[model samples]
Structures are given as structure tokens and as C-alpha cells.
Target chain A: MQRIQWFKWLSLVLYGIPMLLVLVFPFIVMVSTSFKTLEEVSQIPPTFIPRNPTLENYREVWNIIPLADHFRNSFLLGVGETFLIMVLGVPAAYALARFRFAGRQPYLIFLLVTQMFPAIVVVLGVFRVVVALGLLNNLAVVATTAASFSLAFCIWLLVGYFSAIPPEIEEAAMMDGDSRLGAMIKMTLPLSWPGLVAVGVFAFMDGWNEFLFSLTFISNDEMMPLTVGLFRFISRFQIQWHHLMTGSLLATIVAVALFMTVQDKLTRGMLAISEK
Target chain B: MSVVVCKELVKRFGATVAVDHVNVEIQDGEFMVFVGPSGCGKTTTLRMIGGLETVTSGDIFIDGVRVNNLAPRHRDIAMVFQNYALYPHYKVFDNIAYPLRLRKRPKAEIEERVNTVARMLGVQHLLDRWPRQLSGGERQRVALGRAIVRNPKLYLMDEPLSNLDAKLRVQMRREIIHLQRNLGTTTIYVTHDQVEAMTMGDRIMVMRAGKVQQIGAPEVLYNHPANLFVAQFIGSPAMNAFKGRLETDDGKIVVATEFGRFPVGDPLVARLKPDRSPTLGAREVICGIRPEDITLDDAPVTPASPQAQVDLVEGLGADAYVSLTIGGTTLIARTPADCPPAENQLVTIHLNPNKLHLFDPITEETLLALP
Candidate 1:
């Protein structure tokens, strides 16, 4: 290899350092704050590295609220919401890809329009429905609203993937002695593993990161998920940024772990991987 | 004996009729080829028989049982698609054994059958490999193996060799014919290539615009086509067709056209006589002659022979096709390569009187063959 050039180093310093600061500096701050004392966090000429690191915030954040309970609630809601979204999304995607009906284009456009609305708009409408159902403090309202919002986009993503698979594959299965549904399950599903993984990850991450619906629909302390639980560190008098960073890092770790588990299934698309 | 029958079957997709009222009966152990150009309803008819397509009208009988509403699975048939739709997830062995497994056959039996087929197709070494790993010819054999392993009553091959290279297509064509004969399953093969139909089919069904033009043995179709469409469709370089008008002088029928004034033979005269109608005479006609039927001559050897200027000569190994301009028309004559006419050289082409086909210009129906 050629020796490294001075301009290359200069470009790397100019471009890469700024990118690292913009993309990675926040996580670094979050991490350093979580291990610092409240006094050290607000100190003028803030330290890049914690001068004195302590685990006191972790212990305090865990004890100040039901951290484990909030985590468990978030975990359960994410899993349930993702499962429900997939159950609704996969079949809808298959139908849109394979069949033609009079209102199909309009229906698809309507789903896209629904996705275009900001979460601020969705949170209030879902809150109204939750209140009307007498479920303001219930986690079910949060999970349901999260799944509904994610379902539309998940269906559209899967429609593109499902349409990529040729119908001849399923028809060949049918000729080989499977019913229509049997063909789909045996042939289409296995071939669609990538799409399924992507949609599942999308829905799960959507639910896990949602703050608006969880905040609006869940006010009870026990029913609140990690997203709403993060705000418990904030009071009218002062914002406990260290405890907030601790909870946020813990949530990020779990999300990363979930993604790691399903990463292999996400590698291949429907018909492309099978081609020589 | 395996058999399939389509009685007045018709299929329509919205306003476009993919297959018109079609009738076909495939006999036991017969290789029936559906030959046509693209959009000629050949594949649609095959799909209808395979039960992949629902019939818009009429009925289908499989082995003498009316199977109007039977699913493809229950019809006891296997189809080799044009793309060789191998299951991407399954290994070669499992792909071949899938149909047997679906029938709840014993695992041991399934393996034995798969092994036998793989060995027969010479794909035993690739049994554990995915379809993507195989060559084009190997994939075709695997597809053929999958179809034959079940020993179903009927086999439908939809342009199965169309995806391969020219040499491989010929090899696979022979393999399929050999495989089908050994299996003795009634087969209906669809193809747009007339050469494939001519070489492999025991009997070819020529189709055009969703209608059956003619159905017969290959030689019969070559010798006597029912209409102008079949005449133009069944040959490789296609038959040379020219416009002409029929006339009678001194009890002899003569054709007058741009090509030349040529006297009609006895077979054509009997077809034009008073039997079909007393008032029908002096009608517009289309005359056809196969490229091979015309032979080049150095001089006028016969009273009816005509001379023309050679424009192009295409040499194809053992034979040569000479293009000649007779007045304003170009005629292709299949001559032996040894004596092909040089460009700009004048030559006479003597057409066979017995092989002349005359068709009604308007209706396009062959006038010579219809009694």
C-alpha cells in the first residue's frame, strides 16, 4: 500500500472529526453524564471525560422509580405491538401485491396519508379514543396505537418485498400438490424471511422508541413504559439529566441486542438471493 | 393409459379471449405439441388442461372423468414451467420428492424415488446442492426429474427449453422426448418454436389467435395445411406465398399473378370444379410453394418454367437458400450448396406441380385440400 498522504489525513480530520462529533458525541455525553455526579454535570467548562466517575446515578435511577417495571412494560408492549402489526401487515401486504380490487390504489394512498400525519396529531386522536374507552392509564391503549401507526408503513414496505417474489413460485407449489394457502405458507413465507424480519424490526423499534402515545395514553405510574418513565427524572424545579441518560443508554442497549438476534434473517431479499 | 380431453373449452380474460372454443383429445402415451407464435393461446390452453387456469366455458375430461372444477393438485398432473420454477429453499432431492411427500408416501419410498430420478437425470452428485448452483442444462434435467418422479397421469411442458442456449435447448429437447417416451405419460407441450414442435411432437396442433388452425401428424401438416396461417406457420423459412387469380382455358386451370402465369395441376382442378358449387369460378387465390420445392435451372427446361435474377444467396452448411426477384417479387429457393446461383445471375426455378397449395385470397382457407 502507498504511504498515507498529508491531504488524506487533513480531509479525514476535517470531515470525519465533525461527523464523529455530530453523530457520536451525544451518546458519549449521555454515557459520561450517567457516570458523573450532578455537580460535575453542571460544572462550567464541562469536562470531556468525567473527572470523577461514580455508579451512584445508576443506583439512584433504578431506585427513584420502578425502573425494572417500566422496562418490563416497555419490553412486553414492544413485543406485543410488533406481533400484532406483523399479523395485520403481512396478509395485507400479500393481498395488495397479489390481488387487484377497485379501491386498492385509494386504500394504499390512504395508508400513506395516515403515515404522513405527525405523531403529535396521532397521539391526541388515540388519546381521545383511549379516554372514550376508559383506558387512559392502560398500556393496551399505548400498544394498540403504536401498532396501528406502524402497521400502515410496515404493510407498504412488505408490499414492495412481496411483489418482488414471482407468483410462479406459489403456482408451482400449488401444482406440486399444495392448496393456495399451503403454497403461500410453504413457499412464499420461507422466501419472504427477509421482508418479515425487516417489518418485524421496524414495528418493534417503532413501539420501543414511541414517547408521545405512551405519554398521552399512560399516566398511571405502574402502567408507564420506559419512554414515559424517562420523564419522571424531570421535575418543574430541575431536570435530572444524569438519570435520564442512564435510562436512555439502558434502552438503547436492549434495542441493539434485539437487532443483533434477528440480523441474519434480514440479509436476503425475496427472489434475488436465489438467483445464480 | 393416460389421456386428456378438452371439449369445446374456451377461456376469456375480461374482454380478451385468450382461448376460443377449442377441442383437443390427447391419446395414451402420445406427445401432443401446441405450436404457435406468442399470444396464440397455446400456453393458455395448456394451463387450462393443467387446471392452473379456470375455463370460462366448456368442460375438461382427464382419463375420461369430467374435471371441470378440479384443482391442479387433484388433477394428477405435473407441469415444467418455462422458467423451471424450482423451489429456492429446497435442495434438489427434496424438490424432486415434494410431490410424493405431499401424497403422504413413506419417507423411505420418497428417498428411493428421488434417488432413482436423480440418477436417471445424472444429477445424483448435485442432490444436496441448491438450484442456483446448477448449470442451465442440469437445472432443466432437475426440473424434468421433478415432473417425472411423480408418474402423474398427464405432463404439461410450457416452453421448458426456451431458457437454455441453442445447443443446450437441442440437447434438452432430445432428453425431454426420450424421458416422456420412457414414462409413457400423455404429454401436452407448448412452444413458440416451430422446430421444437416439428422434431419432438408425435402430432402438432397449430394454433393462431386463440383458435386451432390444424391438428395432425407433422408430415400431414407439412404436406397439407388447412389454411394460409398453418401453411405459413408450420415451416422453418416459411412457405413462399404469392397472390394470384384463377382462370380456365381449354379445360385447364391456370394461375395468373405477379410471379408468373402457371398452369394448375389436377389436384387443384378437382378442388375448384363444380362439386363445391356450380357458380364458383375465376376467383382470387393465394398460391404457395415450399422453399425446398423450387429448384434452380441453367436454362428453360420445361414449357412453364420462368427465369429470374438472383439477388442474395444464403449458404447454410449442407444447403443454400437463393433469393431471386421474379418481376417485382422475391422468392427464396432451397438449393444444394454446390450449385447455388451467383448474385446478379439469371436462373429458372421450376416449382413442383403436385406440391402447389392454392388458398382463397379473402377467406385465407386452402382451396386445394378441402373436398
Candidate 2:
């Protein structure tokens, strides 16, 4: 047993450390750059740690861009996107999983086909529609765009998740004096908590990090989400690398913190589908 | 009175008829069991009555009210599913109390009734436990408690004990029967096991190929099956069947079979009644006899007793089933365990004339009735 434990430790060190470094090295660089002086950020052969760490970058980043407004915009967009995705995707998924209807196969295939195209491929056409509708600079438009992109995947994942639970659970509830809708609310929804959490997390993350749609639709600096607002530090003349790194680091931390709260349920939901 | 009546009830799924013109009236407090092989529409019939499945045609009446369009909840029925269907997230107490809570009963009433049911099922200790923490038997008891708590007008169980082990099934079978007797609530249970149907039901309805084959009391179904299907299905190890011809030998009617010739008695012929006699002219027939009716005892051997070579012997604690073959025809005979004949031993076995059943080979309908 001791030899096996030693072998396990050796293999982890050999393979795990390099993979961790490859994934986390850029975040480390962001953290270092966020704390470094402006001059230290530009030094040749950049140091792994800042020689002189300062809070100046963090202080000046809010003043450089409307960081508070961008945070609010991102928060609103995430809430709106998550709400829309769940309200629309859950019933569609339940119907897909539970009911038999004409053209269900074709409709599911259509959802799959929609997922194949990246946002870049449809941005021009969407921009034209937005221009025609006079809906530019609208945060709701950005939220809706992001939600539409992830809705298909949300329904697809939940269909498998919901189908794994036996239908007899709901039938028993109905027999126990609940209506069909009530049975779904009391029995099916609670049983699907993990899958719903996973879907909600995905939608929130998509809205929080989306850039192409926000940049195209919201030209207003005050209305821009964090993803687009961070771009203000970049220009043709020069780049405010210190302030940009500081802002990006904060955004990453917020996203990571939100994810940490739901990762347990998210992994369980995904595992349930994969096991099936 | 909680009488449930189904008149020509039918359930058709697209191209296939799952239940065909089934008509049954369950009296108040009757424990009715539907028994059949798998895919025989027994479950479908129970589901239709429970309003889980819609009727393709026909009407269902509960307490003399037309309930064809009523929902399951509105119909006042409780069902125990085969897998127990306990809510995994709820504690046992909450699982049993949920139905009462749904009806918006007083909080005190819900609590009192849930506790009462928990005590009755002997699952009071498990009230705080989730379904996943309990054993299969405990889960089954919790499910029963949930169904019993509401005291609905009718109870429907879809093979509730099929998942239990043999010993647990028998124990649960007795508990359910005792519970039903005490409650005196109308119930319709569906199962494919004949033994369960015989033991639990006040009346058993047998189905095959989407049609009810026979419906009668346990002893009636056992002693006088309407057709070949019920005759073979109702008994364990099944009844021994032999293809033979009705022929007169020395002015006495006898069934000439491959095993041997057996004299047909006058009462059996009289029960055939001349106008209803389908085998008047020495026509081909199928004769059946219960294993217990064939004696393997070494008593005074009569002339007509057939000699069979014992091929196998299976001894139970008090009885043994001996597999015997005569002229390539196999017949199983039950004998006392202490007097099991040796394998390959030729034994003279007397088949009781009163217990012999005759069936028309072409129609597969019983030609002889119980006297």
C-alpha cells in the first residue's frame, strides 16, 4: 500500500504539475502584472514576481474606465440571460423528454444545427436586424443574443438529465392528488435541481464573458459589459497593460467565485448524463 | 360504497389493442386481482381504471358516477407502483404525508395520519430517513403507508411486490391482504404471478392476448377453468395434458391416449350434457389431470392403472414430484417424500376419474365441468 501511494504521488507530480502550470500560468501572469508598477510590466525578460508591487493599477483602473457601470451591466446581463434560458429551455426540454409530437426529431436536429455556427458567422446578419429594429446599445439585446446561443445546449443537456429520472415518480405524485402541472413543479423540478443548476451556471457564464455580441451591439461606453469595457485600455497609439490586467484579473475572480458555488451540482449533473 | 365498474372498457395503442372489451364490476371492499402473462393487458386495464391511461372506448363508473373524463386525482384513487416510487428527496414522514398535504388537510390531521400509518406499517423508526437510506422492504412499506394515508375511494397496485425476494414477497403478500381486510377499501391489483393472484385476491381475472380469459373465485378458477389457457396457467408445474381420442371399449367410454387407456365415468359424461357434447362421436380430445390426483402409492393395483417409467424425482420437504414417461408421453405425479419411487422404476399410477378434465382440441375450450 505504501509503495502504491508513492507511485501515485510520483505519477501526479510528473503529469499533473505541467498541466496545471500550462492552464494557470496566464492567470499568474495577470496577477503579477496587476500588482506590478507600470515600468516593471514593460521590463525585458519579465520577472515571475513583481519586484515592486503596488496598488496604483487597481486604484486607477476604475477611474480609467467606468468599471462600476460595466460591472452593473454585466450583472444585469447575466441575470437576464439566466432567467430567459431557464424559462424557455426547461419546458422545451420537458416536452422533448416527456411528450411525443410531430416533427420532434427534425426540431431537435435543427437545434443541433444551430449550435454548429459560431457567433462570428451570424453577427453581421444580427447587426442588420438590430439596425433595422433600432435596438443598438440595448443590454437586453446582448443578453437575448447570448441566451439564444446557449439555449440549445441547455435543452439538450436537460433532456438527457430529465429522461434519466423515472416517469413513475411524477405519476405517483399525480395519483396522490396533484395535477399534472403541480406534479411537475413539486416532483420533477426538485429532482432536476442539479441539472437546472448546471444550465443556469452555463447561461450566467456565457452572458458574463460574451464579447462579440456586446461589442457589436453596445457602442455606448457606459452600457458596455466588462468584456467590452476592458477593451478601452487598448488603442492604436498605446496600451494601458497594467490597468487592463488589473481589470481582467478582477473579472476572472468574480466568474471563478460564482462557479465555485455551483461546481458540485454541475459536475453531478454532467456525470449523470455521461453515465447514461 | 366504493364500487368501480368498467363497461366494455377498451384501450388501443395506435395499431395494437392493449385491452379489448373488458367488463368487470368490483363490489365495495372487494380485493380484485388481474393476472396474466407479460403483455397481456392486465396492467393496461388497471391503468385505465386508475385514469393513468385513457380509455380508447367504453365507460368507467365509480360509486355509480361516470368517471370517464375524470383525472386520476379527481377520481379519488391511490396507486403503489412496482418500484415503490418513493420520493428520493423527502423523508419517510413527508413522503407519506404529501398526499394529505396536497388535499390541503389540516396540518394536525396530516401529522396525525402520517404517524398512524407509520406505526401501522411498523416503519415509525424510519420516518426521519430518506428513501435511499432504507432497504427495499422498508421502501415498499413506506409506499404502502403513503397509499393508505389518504384512504382514497379505490386502491390500484401495479405488481407492487414483484421486486421483493421470495420470502419477503410472501410476507408482504400476507400483510397486504390483512391490511386490505382491515381497511375494507376496494382495490384492483395487477400481477403476472398466479400464486399471488390466488392468495391475495377475493376474485381473480385472468387475461391473455388483450382479452380476459376467465374471472372467478380462486377455487372456481382452479377447479373449473373455462379454457385451456386458464387450466394450464392457474396451477404451478401446470396441469398434465394428454392428446387422446374418445372411443368405446367393450361398451364403456374411454379416452385412448399414448400413455394408456383410461375409463371415462358416467358423471363426467352426464356433465357434458348431450346438446352441449362436443365429443359425441369418438372425436379427438385433450385430457388434463392435476399432479396431485395421480397417486404413486403401492396399493392394490387395478387393471386399468397405467404403468409409467420414472424418469426423475424432485423431493420437497413433505412431498415429491416424480416425472414419469409412458410410451414417450411425460406425466408429472406428486407423491409422499418418504415413498419416492426410484428413478427408472416402472410404477402403476391411478389417475382419479373425478378429477379428469376434457377439452376440445380444436377450440381449446373445456368439455368437462366440475361436478
iRMSD, per candidate, in listed order: 2.2, 3.7
Colliding pairs, model 2: none
The per-residue C-alpha lDDT of model 1 at residue B230 equals: 92
The Cα error of candidate 1 at residue A2, in Å, is 6.8
Give RMSD to native, each candidate: 2.6, 2.8
Lowest-lDDT window of 10 residues in candidate 1 chain B? B271-280
lDDT of 1 at B339: 78
Q: Judged by DockQ cut-offs, is candidate 1 incorrect, acceptable, medium or high?
A: medium
Residue by residue across A1-276, what tens digits does model 1's lDDT show?
Answer: 234687788888999899888999899999989998888989999987899899998899888889888888888788888889878888898999988778999999999999887778656666677788898877767788788878898999999988987888888888889998898888877787777877877777777777888887777888888988998788899988889999899888887987777665466454555453
Candidate 1 has a TM-score of 0.94
* lDDT, candidate 2, B1-371, per-residue tens: 39999899999988899999998989999999999999999999998888889889999999999998999999999999999999887789999999999989999999899999999999999999878889889999999999999889999999999999999999999999999999999999999999999999999999998998999999999989988899999998789998998887887778889768887777887787465464457778899988998987554377666788899999997999999998888999888899799999888877887788888898888887656
Of the candidates shown, which would achieve the greatest lDDT relative to the real structure?
2
Winning model by DockQ = 1
Provide the overall lDDT of each model, using Cα atoms, as 2-decimal numbers: 0.85, 0.89
List where candidate 1 sits over 4 angstroms from the true fold.
Answer: A1-14, A262-276, B272-280, B302-305
What TM-score number comes out for model 2? 0.94
